[model samples]
Target chain A: MGTQLDPEYVRTLRSDFAVAHKLLSDRCLYESAKWSAEALNGLPEDEVDDPEILIPDELKQLDQMSSSERRQYMLAKACFDCREYDRAARILEHCTSSKCCFLKWYARYISGEKKREEDSEVILGPLDGDATINKQVILIIDEIEEHFRTVAAAVYDPFLLYLYGVALIKHKCDKLAFEPLTRAVNIYPFNWAAWQELGRCVQNVDQLPFVLSQIPPTHVMSKMFEVSTSQELFQSTESVFATLAQLENIFPSFLYLKIQRAMLCYHALEYDDSAKLFDHVVREDPHRLDDMDMYSNVLYVTE
Target chain B: MGTQLDPEYVRTLRSDFAVAHKLLSDRCLYESAKWSAEALNGLPEDEVDDPEILIPDELKQLDQMSSSERRQYMLAKACFDCREYDRAARILEHCTSSKCCFLKWYARYISGEKKREEDSEVILGPLDGDATINKQVILIIDEIEEHFRTVAAAVYDPFLLYLYGVALIKHKCDKLAFEPLTRAVNIYPFNWAAWQELGRCVQNVDQLPFVLSQIPPTHVMSKMFEVSTSQELFQSTESVFATLAQLENIFPSFLYLKIQRAMLCYHALEYDDSAKLFDHVVREDPHRLDDMDMYSNVLYVTE
Candidate 1:
């Protein structure tokens, strides 16, 4: 009998078992979907006809426990799937065992959900399964604080730190965003997205010199100043001239910068300087003539 | 006379100039295409009967100038458009700054068709045209060098480097392909294509430890190996094992890895080890009992 139960017996049993598993799985899936739909529609739990369909007996057994216990079970599944472990942990408030507590914490840690106490043991533990979920949650929280903090704080996870810096800049937390963003960009030099976003972040500041100094001269002269004047009116006519002088030093042969400077001069009614810069740029890079013509139209209107 | 040359005169001149330029440009473009097609097809240049459709007279005239003068002119145009400069420079071989000298050097540089130089400035010149041609040429040259160079060399241009590295790996130049591919990965980490290629490059080496070491431990033990290995016998036994190890790591609790590994082990005739790994993986991840049954059949065959 132990000699593999005979081929025919095994085959029949296998087929029967597969059929049962499939039926159970299909039923479970259908019920899960129904429950999800009812929940999404905000129907009362009692109103759920065959709510049992949504929570299979196996899963419902966990739900029969306290909310915290149900959350613990859900958290384990969530961690397995690498889904919303932080939200699951937040719902699982009463987990007390060190392993369960750390599991909840590490889920937050790895997802960049939040920063907790920097205990070395907790940080270095096997960041797999529920532990990874806690880690992700902690990372997410760290990102939130790093981005929203009035002063920049160092982040342990470089990826999360990079994201945090970008979020800060996006939310107009300029002063808070600068240092971490700068560090992130410096750390990951080949990260083009970080460089582009950091350029945008710094460009938010009023002073042109600070922006010019930070970015590559080519990118600075081409991209930053195109939108800079439009976004920020020069504090004075001389402020515009000073910015132009700094730009000219940075990009000596950049025709577009010269044209932009010329436009600024023309806007200030400094026609001679405007005409000279425009003519010089047209001679050097004749492509600038199209831009110069457009600027001239704007000049005519402004006048 | 100055007053007579007013808006009407200027407009008329502009119209006449535009027409002439368009006609000339169209003619030039057609001739260029014809020449390019001939070159690509390996047709003898002397056999072409159409004299009018040969190189443009203006370009030919520029080619007749002194070498220094031609070089200066070519450099100016190269700064604007590298493809134009390459074509123009190719025709100016008779000049002191011979077309042969510049074309050979520029082609090598643009294609990363030579060994890497330490000076970033020397390597970082105008390669901003026809990236596909550049990649193809670099890949071909890289193959030729694979026979000669005992050590792998760094490929400078990121895109061409990646293509060259991928080709090197395809030809079984694992050691030669490693550096450029690793560099490409470092440059573009999120580039899934590069990552996949890098994985392939490492896998080409027969030793499991070497191959596994190149990838992240989690990846080596997880998903990459499972997805990459085929059921075909053409795939080396070592690769199958590496893939199994990676799958086992990725889905430690999934029975699929165990089944696949068992199949591989049976094929490799390492029946016992395969059975053990498969049994352990399946037992831990009981959700895959169906797969475990299939795996047991393979084990029965091996036994």
Candidate 2:
């Protein structure tokens, strides 16, 4: 049987649980928060009796606080972190609006959450009121554009256009998303993520090369291969294998490159090279055990 | 009339021409090399007489050599660089096949170049009718594989297999191209190039993802908007504008992205944003004057 737990060790464990409880409660991870609180409440007072098993300084700090007070503090912090401004505002209602609720609410609004009437005016009031919110959004986006007008510009601030564009895209306000993303790409020709998202945006429209050419040469090649390899283009195993081989050089480090190559080799009856590359990858990475098994099955049937 | 060229200036230009000549000659960029050589020959003989010209020492040394000898030397270097081994071998026939030539020939052969019968292999010996040469080539390839394996064990080298696979595919060796590209992707999950090529390879032989996924998610949304805007997917002007607006954020600074967006916006009758982006790009980069003219035509029609 396992040795009996030390009274001091049990006390230490209970205190550590209290910190996690406070953190989770603040974040509104309610279930985890409640469970942590309960666990702390259930700690036996007898464990505190043994001097050798005394609670550590860290846990003792929480000893003075009531469970309800700790829960409220943790819950407020969590809501703020998760950008649940309304919930956070309710918890921190006694605090100044501008200091606490206002910033969080603005961040949420910018992240695409619909704003309350009070929050809406507070956030949108800074912009020219004569212009519609959509137009105001456009102006803000334009400001970002002016900042990144050169190739050397630090245009990849995730807070600026990237988040704004993502919000606009998700909202189906594509008209709004266009300028900011284009400005971002123009400022940094090497931003592949922007180029890819752009390709996805204009794929249905005529004249794809215009969008494609804007992407870096390497990214364009990769996107081309991605579109080509997907089942959207072809259905046959033979054609799939053939296409994969053509793109091998562009993505040499990819495991799929070798597996597809091995598959094609098996089909071609070039067993030697196929076996060698396959075995090499499997041996190097145990994570590919499943792939090796599947490959072996194919080889068995083909042979 | 302009003052006579400075002697020092003439010498400097001549030296610049000589360096250019050497680089071009080394690369077998024959036409450029000849131009530089001719420019050196054309330098004025008397430096003091041409005050505007400044001939450098390097150009003076080159100019002292007989034109015939220069031509011979340039031709030999060009032949060597171009891997016209027999031509190089003939020129250096009196000299035993140098170590450099042998190594060069061996490297070329391993890179898949066929060996010429007449060329002497002093260091590695004739590759033809020699099992040892084939074995050595394989060993070298294995060594390269081992080095890559040690450095980037997680990533496979798709280039070699890809090259062979592409050759096989081009030769209707579909079975061959399949495995290498598959292997390429397996090694690198984010290899978009592999994915696109794989799609193309299977397009002819299999049921494409187009049939399976049934209109990509983006296109489905586009079609919905197209219907709402009373436009066909590719036919209606509104559809074009909608598509461009959508793509703006996705491919922000891409010149082609802007052009396509502008084109689509013109079709959709959203002339303002279309013209603005177009005008901005053209105004920012006058080198795209031709594109501006095309955009202007679109604007005229849309307006």
Candidate 3:
């Protein structure tokens, strides 16, 4: 017979279950499932049937099972919930649902309690904006958005609105993006990602050209930029200017759009207009003029 | 000689001031200070004195200042608020007062709104945890902690406790760091940094040796490690175990401490004890045995 487990060890085992409950309460279902499975694995056989000892969330609802239950999604989610991300990714690959596809991508990106080797791997590379998976997700989301746009109810859904806005901005259709993202942020100010993306969409007026000019010899960003820099992204410089000007009505303090308009003028060789705009940009922050270099470039061109 | 600023330009100026006010209201003082300074720099001579235009937070309170008060700290903070990090870093170097030392360290770390040239630099190296300045700052913080520990009131101060705890952990005195950190986290649950440091301290029972062994020949971490693997850092392993055991009484579910204990035993060649501990660990989470490599090594050694 197995020697009785140390009481502290048993308490720790139970606590993992409690931690899972807390995670579940916070909607981190995958982590919760992992901890629950841990608790079960470590449970003393004598206490196995005790509800208070290790009562799972759904165990109480076991009597209410319906016959037509399609549980593959649930099983896949459970696998994810248990921190079996590799397995979850495999399960998601076979699933045709858009959520599953997103989950497949998500499983690859989001990590569990990061241990040493994984952390060292993180330390071996650059950390910012490496969410390259977002691009593919954006494409998937774009397809979803197109399908939803046809539905009357979808226009009112904030999540769908956020997705649509994100997709548009990713595709360099920022003019079409502003309304939905603004609306999404209005509905939920807590979306730091949406706020950041909205800020970018508003800032970048000629994204297609900018992306092309900025694409490194070796980039680790989204493939969206590699295949697509369509001139169609910019309807016309004047049209872009007009739309940006219209946006300034809502965000009058957004200096980025002002600079974009200046650059557009500069590119068109409207030296007087460009000079006026550059002067205003320099005037705004006379100290450490982040725009001073640009203004100098304008001067070089005009001279 | 300069023509009166265009009406639209003046309107944008006013709007920027309004934006600064909103940022200030949200307690984003740095961004607000920056925007305010921008508006001030942009203002026409007539509008420059207009209190309605870009009055920074302290402008109304300026009259209350004592005659001996120098405003270098305020000016430095203003520079920081404006996101002129490099300039702020330069300015901070000349300020020798210990009070300003923390501010100097802070300025170097919190970057300005990241622009283009810097984006490529991040991709060229590991992106995050480049807090290499932690080594230099640890010495400064050590001095601060030493002074604070003598003051009766300092123990009650959460910030002081946090600083002390952080200094201790960073200096590899993690064993002795538990008291202040535990107190700090007890006082403030939202101190994610404190919690993280606390977790690290608890987990790293034998960090110096582990780090020495784990250091990849071509690692990109700070040169501080290569310089400072001194022998005095390690005390008795039994003492560390005893202290950890004491702590686990309060934090019974500290799996990290448990793993640390198991590893310590494994290192000491107490294979029977380690095997039992490792069994519990594997039983706790069968999937993604983050310590599988070590566990296998232990098995090989034991067999």
Candidate 4:
């Protein structure tokens, strides 16, 4: 155990790590889109990070509810929260609130994925996890794709827009993913998930400048997006480095910053310098496994 | 099957629903804290909504790695991401990056939870899940409390600070939690999760003013926090309504805004008006399960 610290001491450490994390991670995901498929493949099944729904205790009093209202919103929500997506969706079939609308379709979307999972297991047995081989998944994806496309158009909700883009991409309509994803980022630029989806729509380094032009250049997210895209596309190394340096002013001693720097050195083919940076990163964060593959390559090439 | 809609249609409807959702959900959670314990209890175990870590595909090529540098970051990360918390923590034992430090301790904290879960199963058989009954959990919480207290002092990382506050609260040192939570909200006001946590530490109506004073007054999140705490404490109904009205200018037709208004009506004994608003909500979102209990109450009281 260490010395007992005062609560007052920690109160002074005030910085928006949420925004910082979003800016960094969105860019990282953008950069990873071109270079890393595994990371993208391994995301949690539910993409929407919805805030936990809180019901008032006054409402949950068992004796208070009349028998007729048994088929109520909380019932459906309880099912949804318990991961009973189909049941939740069923209960929410006629509800009209935007939250209900979003949840209904979202629950359906998840149920579709769960269906696909079960189908894949049945079809592939030991090899069943692959969605490509599971023909049943295509039908589920197509249905969800349709559901999202319809609702996304009507609601224009950022989360729905982001999901629409993802659905289009999943349905192999990568070309169609660009518009909704772009709209999502423009409307809610703070959502790294939307930005990540939009970043995936870009085909090459040549497409990046046009994509960058579409986003708000002055916005920090746009700037972060540019940096991540440039890093992935292996272009504008100097500019990207400068932007990273600027970010460093805000996020000093940030682990990802060091990794980004090391990556920049690697891209420049300054293998010795890159190796030094990697060595430093290793020393600083021995538990970090995020960029070790690059570190290994640097060592291999130098050796 | 739905009609094939053009992506151009959704492209035309660009509004920042993320901001809308945040404002609404944060308020709902605040209201829930004071009235509903079960809703709070049902939250997912790991609370920080982190962006998925994306490693470049180029970095993951297996043939490239030489044997010596095999004990790298990727291995530890793989374990961590796979939920092998103890193994990941073991691998990252000496790592020095802030991310590594955070992960190492987070892994320990989770492992402690896992241990508690197992202990609960063993001691209680059927009754083991209740943390209060488990003496072993106290030790785990105390250890984590010590670790967070020490690191939170040095790092000043917002996530760490948030966790420190949470740990302190969990350790039943509620008074000590206030300062760190306040710092967390002031620094990264955008995180509803932080606001939710801070709101939890507030014990009464009198403490609300001082807590409000500590936060940036003009910030939207501060306003949201104020509305939430006010609603939970059932104080400042008129002012809270005014704030919600102002919020409505930005998030017009948002479900939660409607819910908040209806809730205000319910609080003010405007039961008839509240019932009508809820009726509208039901008509619009028949599938919605959130806040149905309250809706049920209005019906019961009216009947």
lDDT (Cα, tens digit) per residue for candidate 1, span A127-188: 53334322343344453563336433432333334455655554456677666665654443
DockQ of each: 0.01, 0.01, 0.03, 0.02
- Which has the better DockQ: candidate 2, or candidate 4? 4
Model 4 misplacement above 4 A: A1-94, A107-155, A276-293, B1-109, B112-303
> What's the best-to-worst order under TM-score?
4, 3, 1, 2
lDDT of 3 by residue, B181-272 (tens): 66654543323344445556534435545444433332211112222122123332655565555434423443444565677677677877
Between candidates 2 and 3, name the one with more favorable lDDT.
3
TM-score of chain B of each: 0.28, 0.27, 0.32, 0.61
Docking class of 3: incorrect
- As a whole number from 0 to 100, the lDDT of residue B195 in candidate 3 is 44
Instruction: Report, for every candidate in turn, its global Cα lDDT versus the true structure.
Output: 0.41, 0.42, 0.45, 0.55
- The Cα error of candidate 1 at residue A286, in Å, is 14
Q: What lDDT is reached at residue B155 by model 1?
A: 24
Candidate 2 CAPRI grade: incorrect
**Model 4 global lDDT (CA atoms, 0 to 1):** 0.55
* Winner on TM-score (2 vs 3): 3
B1-303 per-residue lDDT for model 2 (tens digits): 223555675556445545555433333333334334433434455423212223345333323333223223333333443344444434322321222222223333333334333343545654433322222334434443444455444434443333334444434556555666566544422222333344445533133333223322443223322222222122445445555445343323335445655655555677787789788777643333324665867677657
Q: At residue B123, what lDDT does model 3 achieve?
A: 44
lDDT of 1 by residue, B1-303 (tens): 112223443333223222322222222222222212211112111222221123334333323444234323333322313233333333332334322333433343443432222222343355322222233344454543442264334323333445556556645676787776666545433223454566565443354355445544443222344334343233436656665554443234334445566666666667787778777765553332334554666577657
- Count of residue pairs whose backbone atoms collide, per candidate: 43, 94, 5, 23
